[model samples]
Structures are given as C-alpha cells and as structure tokens.
Target: MSFGPPPSLYTQSSVAADQRRRKRRRTVLLCAVAAVVAPALAVGAWLWWPGTASDDAKPTAAPAQHRLDVRETVERRPASTQGVMAVRLSTDDLPPGEAHEMPGLWATDKILAKGINRTLVGVAIGTDAGLGEEAWKLRLGGPICGKTRHVTVENRTAVLFRDSADKESLCNHVAFVDLDDGKLVWQAEFPVSGYVDKPDAGSQWDPGVTLTHATVTVTWGDGTDAYDMDRGKLRWRVTSREDCISQGAGGGRALAVRFRCYDADDPQSRSTFEIRALDPRTGRSRWTYTPAVGVKDVRIISTTPTVLATSAGDVGITEIISLDARGKYRTTIPLQGGAYVAECTDEITYLATEECPSLAVGAGQVFLTSKEQGDLIHNANWIIGFDLKTGHSVKKFESGPNTLLRPLRMSGDRLLALRESSDRISPMALVSLNPRTGAETPYFYFSLPQEGELFSTTEFADTVVQNGRLFFGAKEAQGPADADSKAWVWLAFGIESAAAKKP
Candidate 1:
C-alpha cells in the first residue's frame, strides 16, 4: 500500500502516538482537578453541617493547673504481736492499739491515721488482742466470707460497704458510717436471688454506682436501681438476670449500664450482653441493645451517655460493641488475636493481650516495656491502645508480665495504668503507664511480709487519684511468721502533670 497517499506508515504511526499522548494528558488534567476538588467539597460539607454538641464539642481543656506532688509516705507499723488486715483513714487522729488476747482469738491495738487535711480514708483488718478487735469491730458491714466486695465514699460524710456474712443471704447488705466520727449513718439490706443460691433473691452483691444529679444508679446482681442520696430513698429498680452490672455516668441526667448475661453450662454462652440507658431521675429506660455474642467476660469499659461493651470470646477473639444514645447498635469491631479490654474513653479504648499489648485505631503500634518478654521468660505483658473512632490499633506499651493491670484511670490527657506483682516477697510496685505513647513510669513499689514461706503476697487497699495526686496504699508484711505483718503504708505521689498528657 505504498500508494501516493500511503502516507508513510511511519507518519501514520506517529499520528496515532500523538493521539495517545493527548488522551493521557487529558486524563491527567481531569484527575488533578478531581483530587483538588474532592477534599474541598468534603471540607465545605463538614463546615456547613449544623453545629451540634457532638460536632462542635469543644476540645477538652488542658488539665487544670496541677502537679504530681509527692505529699506524704506514712509507714504504719502495728504493735509487736498484732497482724493488720484492713486499714482505713479517718479525719481525726486516733490512738494506736496494743496487742491483747480475747476469748478465743488474739487481738492487737487498733491504729488510725487521722488529722490529715485531705479527704483520705483508709480501712484495715488486724489479728491481735486490742488492735484486731478494734479493726474488725469497726465492721462497716460484713464478716463477708470473702474480702469486702465494694466500698464507696459519700461526699466525705459516710463510707458505704456492701458485704455478705453468710452464703444463705442472697442480697448484699450495705452499711454507712461517718468518716470523721466513725458513727454509723444508716444501713439497709438488699436481697438478690436467681443467680446465686440463697434465701434472699433479687438483691445485688457487687454493686456498681454512678451518680447523676443527686441520683445514684446502682448496678448489682439482679438488676439496676436508682437511689436518691440526699433523701436516702429508693427511686426505682429494673430487674435483669445479668451477672456483672457496671454503670457509667455522663452529662447531667444520662446514665448507661452494662449488663452481662451468661449461660451457666456453656462457657461460650457468656456472649449474651446488653447495654441499657435510662433517665437518672425517673428511672425510665431510654435504650437497650444486644451486641454481638461469641464472647464471655463482657464488661463496661467506659461510656459517654453511650455504651462501649468489650467481650472476650472463646479461643482468642475479642470484640468491642458501641451503642448509641438510643441504645441502638452502632458498630462492632473484632480485635486481632485476643485482648483484655480495660477502659474506654471518648477517644480510645485500652486493651491488653497475652503476646503483645499495643494500641490500635488507624495503625497498630506496640508499647515497649522496660523489661523484655524473653527476660521475663515470656512473661512480659503489654498494654495496647485502640482508637475509638477508627477501630484500628494505635500503640502498645509494656506492662511487665508479673504485673496485674488494674482499670485505666483518666486524668486530663494522661491515662493511668496500675499494675501489681504478687511474685516478689515484700510489697508490689504500682506502675503508671502513658496509654498514648506506651511509656511507663513507676508510681509506688513496696511489699508486705508473708506469714509462712514468704509466698509473695501484696495487697493494695485502693488506687485513687484526686486533684492530680495519686494516692496508693500497700500492706507490707511485718516479718516472716508474724501474723502482724499486715501493717499498711499510704504513698502519695504527685505525678508530673506531663504524665497526664494524652498521646
């Protein structure tokens, strides 16, 4: 086809190449415009959206001016022959008791730390003549076969204890007393049945509390109830057969409850869970939701009028369920490996796993521990972070393997991780980890002596943080074979305000 107009094959080929080039250029230009316009459109839509509290909520103000000031470390040693069980702090200065003998038991002198210009309160039990009787007799409530189940402070006026003396009693009883005068305020017995074997039914044992506008929502064995603290009147009660009851308070009148219902026969039956919301004043149900099943040990990690239920399923599956204000299911997220869900905030949820503890939200980040897993013989434990909004892991920090991770405490931006190790002979260390960056700082580390063979026992009275100061108390063993080895010491540490900074 070398005809005159054959237009050299080369020329034709060149023309086709030119057309291809133009098409590509046009495509590039269009792509460039789309890229530049799409983001702009999104920004415009976001800015134009009506301003709602959920959208325009102001950023949390920086933690008020505060410091982690080490205020005091009191070493309280009981008398020579006495063993202390529970120690409590009161407003007045009380005399220490001397060891004495009673009808069938030995008693020691009672010791009370008083006259501290703080709302600090502590309680301890002792074994000896004078002290033991005084300590045990204080009886906020209980000969509770097990340790006291719950202790709550009420406006510095009274301390409430929920304890059980006999297995026949289904409901846990409550006792209130003046913190300053040690005067009994009021006591009431609640009956719980259905879950446990006992005469009293419907009363809760391990009751959780959330106060809203003078109303306290108590979650316990059989259901959720609201009480008016000021009037000391029962407002209303809702019955459900869930095992563990947890409550979260937010805003002024909103409250959320995490109800756990498990199958007695099938461990996997533990998956049944529900998060309910109600009006704190009227006790009217606002919303209810059944999150996905397949997990047991479901707990209320945290909430904001919203409920976040985290469950540890069979094998190594962990799931997080978010319920909206209407108690409707918002989303379900499956965590890699299995995780022990701790606390959840508006921003993130903290998780701990067996192999590696890390945070997730967008990208998974691992937290580094001061000690290595290999060094601890694969005992190193990690505290992982997960972003609440994105459903991805964010960071992981090392919380030593021997350490028992307590609940996550939020102070401003800093997330507090409390861990205790009972492996050591004396006292255990209370470590504080930065949840955001996975950096850990030791808060208090001490130990008490054991009665025989030094079987590494450490007891933490309470971990409370107020006004930027962390108050941790530990019971140190007096000495080997000494029943009096259970004296307590309260350590107050002023954490660097920076420790509270969010990651």
Candidate 2:
C-alpha cells in the first residue's frame, strides 16, 4: 500500500510546532546542565581530589568514539524444503483505475487512497466462474467518488471507509458500510488529526487504526481512543503519562494493543524502553514489562495473543526478546551472528522510512528472518522458527539461493513467504512453509498486471488474512500528482491453487 506522505498537505502548523518544541528542548538541556554539573564537580573535588594538581601530565590520546557495529551480511547453513506444492492464484486479469484526484494547483487534493481490498477467489481448475463485480469496483468505485481515500473490509458484509469530510473539511468521519446494500452502519470522527491527511515519516507519536469485535481503536499523534462499533460513540480515551511519550502502537485481531511508551527526553537511553498491554474498550493497562540491563530500548517486531515479539539491544546489535501474555519475559534469543531484526510498520509515522522488524509472530511459532552471505548481493533470506509456547528454536527453512524471501501472512498453520523472482521474464512467486516441520511448499504466482520494470520492485502492504482469503493492496506510485497519477491494485491470493488461468 502507499504508506508514504500524500502529494500535498497543510504542514505549516506541524512545522511551526516543531520549531517551538526545539526551543523548549534547548531550554531544558541548558537547565539540566546547570542544575547537575556544578554540584557533581564540587563533590568530586572534595572527596576524590582534595588538592588541585600543580601540573597535569600530558593526557593520553582520547579513546575512539563507538560506532554502530553492524555486519553487512552473515552466512547461514542451508535448509531443505521438500514435499511442498507450488501454487499460483488467478486475478481475472483486472487492472486498477485512477483512485486519486486533483482539484487545483494551490489546494491539495484529498482523494487519495493507499490501496484497495478484494477477496481471493479459489475456484476449481477449468471450472471458472466470472466475478460478481470488477475487483476494483468492489473496493474503489460504485458509491464512493474520488473523495474517498481509505477503505478497509470490516468483515464479509461490511467495510470501513474514510472520506475527505474530516481531514480536508474538518467533518472527517470513519464510516462503516454494509457491503451487501452499501449503507452506512455508523461513522466516527476521531478526536485527533482527521482521516490521514498525510503519512508521517516514522515517529513515536503517530496514528494507528485497527478494528476488532465491532470496536474501532485509534491511536493518533496525541492520544489513543476507542469507539463502539455501532452508532459510533466513544468508549474510552487515554493520553500518555507525564515524562513518557507514546511511541509506535498497534493492535491484533483480539483488539488488544501492545502500546509502546518511551521517555520523552531520552528516547534512545537505557530507561526509554517500556511496553504494556491495553484493553481497548476500557483504555486501561492490563500488564507491563520493562527490560533491565544491557538493553537500551525495545521495539515491537510483531505479536500474537499469547506472545509478544521484540528486539532488544544497544545500537545495531540486537537479540529477540519474547514475552508471554502476562507481560513476563519468556526467553531471550541472543544476538545470532550480530544481526538485528528488520521491521516495517503498516501505519508509518511522518517523515520516517520503513522499520526493520526482526521477527514475526505466527500460529505456533515466532518467525525470524536471517540473511545468508548472498543476501548482501541478492535477496537470499531465510526463515528460522521458534516454538511459541517455549520460545525455543524449532526449525529453519530456506527459499534457495540467489532469491529474496519475505514473510507474508500465515495461511491456516503454514507461514507464507513471498519469493522475489530473479528472472526478468518471470513474476514474483509465493511459498508456504509449515512452521512445525520446516516443510516448504514452493512456487505460487499471482497473475498481477505486468508494469514492466516497476513490477519487480512493487511492494505489497496492509496484508490481512480475512474470511479464509488473503487480501493485500499495492500502489505503483506512492502518491498521486496531476502531472503523473497512478491507481492502486488489490490482489487476493486465493486459498485454492488449482490449475488456474495464467494472467
């Protein structure tokens, strides 16, 4: 999905806020130095050095500053994948149309959507039936015009869509629509910044939206709020505690949020890391965990209901630190070959690049990606499985050499990995690996529209496994412009991979 900033947004106020914050920070730093440094020096002189030295010997050369000790690549033992079948899904050769609109030159256009969502159809081979509606029509067109910017499938029969009413016009509302009749079930106007006017680069404070159990929990730049599914009423609202800042936060299917809290003054220091679980409805803390010693801070890699996966370390050296449901430490997987977890967030903060998440949480295991020696040259990535209950290393699976692999969503109990095709004429492929047995099924292709050179670099985002089907959105270009505009594509990788027609 297009997780980057919109083409144009009114960011002058945001920029002014930053300037004010910088002034406050400089004032605070100067006060902190004056309050502590002079007292500390007097104490040191009185106790340690009672008399001043007449002449000091030549000072030894100062020690070199510490730099991030990150290795470019690490080698790994190859693992075998046998007894798996390669499968590809049919897209019906449907292409997307323009989803973003531009009104004028001075005014920014509000009709921008990240991507569309469509269901995966897995029919039997040679028994193809036509789709009820054009896939893009199912997600983008029809009742909604160019003003609609965000649309998410709430359930089989309903969807959540946000239009220009809120961010662009100050009447922003996130409305739920019944898919069968296209009627608004309810709509909510969040308290903070309206429907995403722009995407943040990456910051501790940003917006994250998730819907579960007919409840919508939104964490925006200022605070977190939860709304009832029906009638769109506020259930709970919360702001961060003093001296602490709200970092990245997200929720799973269960509607529970593992919100991150960091010390505002020193986000990179030893005491900055903190994590806690919140009951979305109540806006109350359920459990909390703070790592001790040697770890500077904690970043969420991924999480399941029972397991929270994260990477902990100082600088680039990191170890996988998993915690159980109660927020107790489960196990610490030490730095394996000096590698850290690479992560990316669906709700990217403003001005931030994608994150490097170290691991992903799966059904019965936590999945970790490790770089082979060839990863530096090509996309040779591997997956390592750890038992969920015990947090123990279980198995390793490889997607062969000279190919890059990315962990997508889990289908049933198997972990789905996207295999980036190396051949110029070939499209990307998909593989499924049973986390328990380390058995990988190979080579499933999506009949996506071929965009020539852009197809190879096209990245998929907002991947969700819903109603036994996989739905994800992709954008050829991140944002829309009057000069050059592109539409969004929604690909549904059907569960049934029979002999389907190629694109």
Candidate 3:
C-alpha cells in the first residue's frame, strides 16, 4: 500500500538512541537528589533578543556531566521567563545560490550538527556550543537520501546518500559518521535493481538504512544486509523470498523490517504487508506482526515496545497499535475523530520508521497531544498519555489558554514539551511534564525576532533541546528571490539560561 512521498524534505522528528538513553538515566538520578521543583512564572511582556536585557545572557560551553542534568538546573529557578543566550543563524558561509533542502539535525554536549545540500551534494556541518560557527564539515558524495536517528554510545551515526552528483543516481551508499570528531568512519555501497520511481509501484523499495547499538542494517532492492557498526564488514544477509520485496528496515534497541509479498499466480492481484523483528547482531527473525488486510500505511513508533501508527483504508493515521515483545496484539487506540493529532505526515513514505512527529512512547504509555480548541487569541491544547497495554488515558497535561504544548523529547520518565509562543504578547517556553504526578516545570523562556519567529515551529525547522538549551534550525534554505534581493532564511537559533531577571 502506498502512503505518499518518501522521507524527503518534510520528515519532521528524529533523535539518536544513545543520546536519549544517557539523558533519561541522568534525569532520573538527578531528580532523586534535587529539591522540589518550582512552578512556571506568569507570562512576561514580549521581549526580543539583542539590544535588551536578554542580550547580557551569553551561551557557554556546558560541562560534560551537566548536559543531561537540565532538570536539576531548572529546579533552582523554575519560573524564570528571561532570555539568556539567544543565538540566531541568519545564513552560513556555504556557497549561496538556489534553495537547498537541509535534511538531518543532531546535537551533542559540545556541538550541534546539521545536514546541508551544497550544490546537490550532501554536507554535514557542525557548530561549537551553538555559536553558529562552522567547527567542521564532511562532504558526502551526493545528496543525503536517508539517515538513522539512532547513534552509538561513542557518538557514531549512519547516513544514506547517492553514489554520484548525478540527480538520477539512486541512493545506494551508506556511511557511518563520527559526530564527536566530525569524520566519516566507514561507508559501503550496495547495488539495487528493478527500481521503480512511483510510490504505488514500489519507489519505497529504494535502499534504506538504520542503526542499532552493534549493527547497521540496510535494505537493498530485494533483501536486507546487516553490517558491524565499527567496521563495514557484513555481519549477516537475508534475501527476500521469490514473491516478496523488502521495503526497508528500522532500528533502535532492536531491528524490524517491513515488506510485502505477492501471490505467485498474479503479482498485481495479491498484496500483503508484514513486519518482522530481526536480531540486531544476527539476521534471525524473532517475531512477525501483520496489520489488518487493507492497512495502507504503517510507521514504526518505537521498536522496543513495538508500537505502530497505521491507516486502514483511510488517508492519515486512524489508530495506534501496540504489540507485546512476543508480537501479540496488546491494544488498539482508535483516532477516528479530530480529538487528537499524532502529526504523522504522508511525505514520510520510504524508510518510514520514526515518522510519528507528535507522539512519544515510554514508561508503558504513549503520549499524544490533543487538538487545538480555540483561535489565534486563545488557543487551547493539552497532552494526554495512554496506557499501551490497556489503551486507557492515564495522564493529561493542559496548555493553558494562551499557549499550545508540543512534545519535543522524553527525559527519563518525564516528557519535554515546547510551549509555543502564542503571539507578540507572550514568548515560547520549554517545560518538563511528569507522567506520574502531572507536574509541569518550566525550563526557560525566549522569543525570536518578529521575522525569525515563524521558523521556530517544528514543521518549518528541526528542534533540539540539549545542555539546558532549545535550538530551532531551518529544514531548508532558499536563495535570494533574485540576485539583488536578500531572504530572511535563518539557518539556526538557540535559547539558554533560565535564571529569571528582576521584573
């Protein structure tokens, strides 16, 4: 079944697995010894960066151990709404010409890395501590076709790119890049045949790549291959059956593949989509789960819990399916009406893993944001968590009438949400929500220049909350409308410091 487009310029959310686990563990430990966290402050007068008191706040290189301990820092003064290090990236030094589609964005304790399309080729660019300066750059041979949000403990991740600068070159090359050193550790190329350019006919069959702790798996046209994460040596290979085609693979703590099989008698008449779990170290199938017969799209939410967002006969995601470790169906949460929005985009067709932008799964619950209730002046929203095994709404965090809450990332047992800047009267803030107590603690507050505010949304840019800072980077940058005119395209911007200033 064809969902829509591939994971191209519009793919929304992605996070490295290693980074998440480390932060989760650190957050849990920090909360145990920290003092009681304070509540958020009242909304302050709209204030922009630079040329104001907020300008005095500067970005500093955070200590290594404090990277994931953002909760502890906020507890000292949780209600602060003052700005700190407000770094805005107007445009980088990359040769300016036509617009470029910037694909991936990842962050570490010391640097923030972004994917750039430099003249049709893929270039990985890094900045030191949100300074907006290029610390290093790695030029992939061609435009990045796909990438895995999972990173190894040593800060290594994989990316998929084309073989040459030719626009028609298929994305058949995969490489592992070291984020800390900004170096390409290893790369390998696989050949794919009988490729189709149409979604319905199987353009989603393009080679896809994903990373696990010990393995990097890629799906060629007909089958799948698993390689060692450190070295590019092939660990195991699985060829597809004569009547089946492997769509792609997704990985985290475990690996899973989604493919379809056709009837031997009539290839066009029969179709069945299946998802199978494979051991990361070896290529053995552990369990398989098949959705209802006509489920058109299936996106992997989390591999460990085996959650999937599926659309049956309808267009967008109609429900969320939870499965047990043994592949047994646990529960199905129906989303037929417009009460809740998971933000699953149709453009994420190929390697459709990790595509649910507005949903977070953890602590035996799947958290989702409720639909907005009001208009521009008084927008209302809330985040509700549902038990994965019982499909019951267990927790709810409201976004007061002035702001809307969007889940950014999960920290330990808490969920980090972006409190959207409602209007010129209010500023955007970050808060951590507790599933157990329903308590929300404010992290920091900052506002973008009037012109730079639009890019702050997750749809227009990529977001990263690290080292007690929140960053928003453009997903794509277009050149000047003409040669003589300039465009207000922001490459990236970040907010730090949560210490409230005297009102």
What is the per-residue lDDT of model 3 for residues 405-490, given as tens digits with 9 covering 90 to 100?
89876665667778775654566777677777776666676554445555556577777776566767677776543444333345
Model with the higher TM-score, candidate 1 or 2: 2
The per-residue C-alpha lDDT of model 2 at residue 9 equals: 17
The number of the candidate with the highest TM-score is 3
Clashing pairs in 3: none
**How would you encode candidate 1's per-residue C-alpha lDDT over 150-169 as one tens digit per residue?**
12233222222334443333
- Displacement of residue 371 (Cα, Å) in model 3 is 1.4
Question: How many collisions per candidate?
Answer: 67, 20, 0
For each candidate, what TM-score against the reference?
0.50, 0.55, 0.78
User: Where in model 3 is the C-alpha error above 4 Å?
Assistant: 1-81, 86-88, 92-97, 118-133, 195-204, 264-267, 345-350, 498-503
* lDDT of candidates 1 onward, in order: 0.35, 0.39, 0.64
Q: After superposition, how far is residue 20 of candidate 3 from its true place, in Å?
A: 45
Give the best candidate by lDDT: 3
